[model samples]
Target: MNQADIVIVGAGAAGLMAARELSKEGKKVLILEARGRIGGRIYPLPKEEWGYEAQGGAEFVHGEAPVSKALLKEAGATLTHPTEWWSVRDGPPSKIERLSPHDLQLEEALKKLTGDTTVAQFLDSNFPAGEHDDLRNFVQSWVEGYDAADIHKASALTLRDEMLDQGSWRQMCIREGYGLLLKYLQDACMQNGVEILLHKAVTAITVNQNGVSIQCSDGLIYQTKRVVVTVPLPVLQTLQFTPPLPKKTQAAAKIGFGGVIKIIIRFKTKWWTGPREQPFERLFFMLSKEPVPTWWTQHPEPHTTLTGWLPGPNAEHVKNHSDEEILTLALLSLSRIFNISIEQLREELATFKIVNWIKDPFARGAYSYSTPESKEAVQELHRPVDNKLYFAGEAICEEDANGTAEAALASGLRVAKEIRESF
Candidate 1:
């Protein structure tokens, strides 16, 4: 049987970070990743394919991501900020208003919330139905599209905290792509003698007094003093524990795992910033009521590409659709938004790729969101069972950065500290 001091399941940001930290303390660390490649949801597309390093998965560095920022800096990656934001209803695209009267009222109501509840309940109680329909719709879209959360289950208090933290509306993109940062972490772990085995999907974990035995799908059993599971909540739910961690698995189910369908379309030219009646020269983001409600450009970087974001329930709606069907939907949405012909879009299209995280076997969903019960659920998961089975991931992070890379990195660091303290 293979042996190590600690074995980490999933080589994503959390697992990689944990391995690096534990290896620094002279611990024998082994990281097993189900996927052939590392970086989990942080999939960076080939630079040559799109003339730039386009992202296939996680993109923006939302708000003040201290952990992500520090890692980017260490990786020697440059950060670029998007310039403009626009929205469209029927006519031409226009600049998005930062705050409306309804938004102000919603903000005030959110501040008065004393207890945790679902976003849907909060909206119904405060905003009501008829007069506040716009506000309700906006809130629903924001919750579903931006946070990739379901309004009926997503925590209102958590959303409020996230909104307050994002009051500055600061977002940054890495010039070299997030892959560079992951490479840095992977390299650091390797240099510290942390062994990372790819395509080793962990099937069952048996914990005993002396140590723990991890069984992979390939029939390899690894004996380790401890195991850190950093997979997504959905994947975690499917993992088997020998002693049966009913509470941990049950808690994992309580945490909301959201889906996302990201569509990247590369064009032959920057047609959006063209000699049309109203040019989208400074178009950074565009929102509409189309099937794919959100779209954005690689603004400030002169890239001729538009990324379509269909998240949460919207993505789930088309989860079973084929790639061709999804691509057609994306094109149709863009055509309607730009008042351009679908044929013209086809002609201008250079290359395209669709990323359906909902269908990804290892991921199952994009990331985690907070439910009213998520705080307690996350707490339960954080407490290691028998001091042998520990959990660390974005879902385990019971903070404002629950859905971002920062959260994953922070959780990894926290678990590493916990393991070291135990030793």
Candidate 2:
């Protein structure tokens, strides 16, 4: 048996960060990642692969969290905010940019929320049926756009909590891709003597009073005093935990993992003329009706690539369709939104790509979201199971910060501290 002081399953932000923390105390740690690459959902594809810049997974840092801020500051990473938003609404599709008070409306609506209500309930009670439909759409769009959440299922408390907790409404993106953050963590792990084994998918974990034995699909075994399972929530649901904890199982069912489809389309030329008759001109984002309602450009950085986002129902809707069919849907959405002909779009389209996190066996879905029982479920995950099996991931984070890389990193540190104190 391959023995270690600790075994970390899934080398995403949480596992990698935990390895660094444990290594600081001279704990022998082994990190096994199912994917061939690191950085989990914060993928930054090389230009060689797509002939243009792209972030296949995580795109923005929503706020200035301490963990994220410290790492980013240390990396000498310059954080740049995207430009003003523009829309292509029904009236004439003019290029004139209009100042939108989207945040004000969203904030006012969020302030009225109370109790254990879902987003659907909040919207219905506040907006009614036909009146204030725009207000409803504004909040719903933010829910799907930021949370990648299912409106009917996710807690209203979650949305309210997130908005309340933010120190800044302005979102920041790394001038360099998000991969830089992962690289720093990866280097720290290596320097501290953590052993990282990529492409090692852990199939089963057997734990007893003495310790834990981990079985990998690669036909190897690892024995450790403690194990940190940081795999995605959906993937965790499918894992075989010997003498399973019923609470963990029920908790996993309570918290939700949402579906999302992201597409980065590289165009031959900058399509939006400029900031006027060209609403898309220098536009950071263009939000519209669903199937693919969200699109954003690599603005202020001279790039023609525009990312298309499909979350919640729209993402779930296209799960079984072929690549060609999915591509067509994206293309059609853009064609109608921009008022460009199909032939023109086809000609200008350089390359298109999709990240199938939903269908990926190891991921199973995008990130996690809050359910009514999310707080209790999350607290249960925080407790060490039999002093042998510990859990750390975005899913196990405090209800408010439950779906971010910062949360994952913080949780890793949290569990490592617990393990050390236990000894």
lDDT of 1 by residue, 246-349 (tens): 99999999988899999999999988888876768988889898999889999888899999999999899999999999999999999989889999999999
Where model 2 places Cα greater than 4 Å from the true spot, the runs are 50-53, 89-109, 130-132, 162-169, 274-276
Model 1 residue 51 distance off true place after TM-score fit, in angstroms: 2.0
Candidate 2 on 57-167: residue-level lDDT in tens? Answer: 877776656787788788778888777665565345433243233557567777776677788887787668697777777677767767788888888877776666654
- What local lDDT does model 1 show for residue 374? 91
Residue 104 lDDT in candidate 2: 73
Task: Give the candidate number with the greatest TM-score.
Answer: 1
What TM-score, to 2 decimals, does candidate 1 have? 0.97
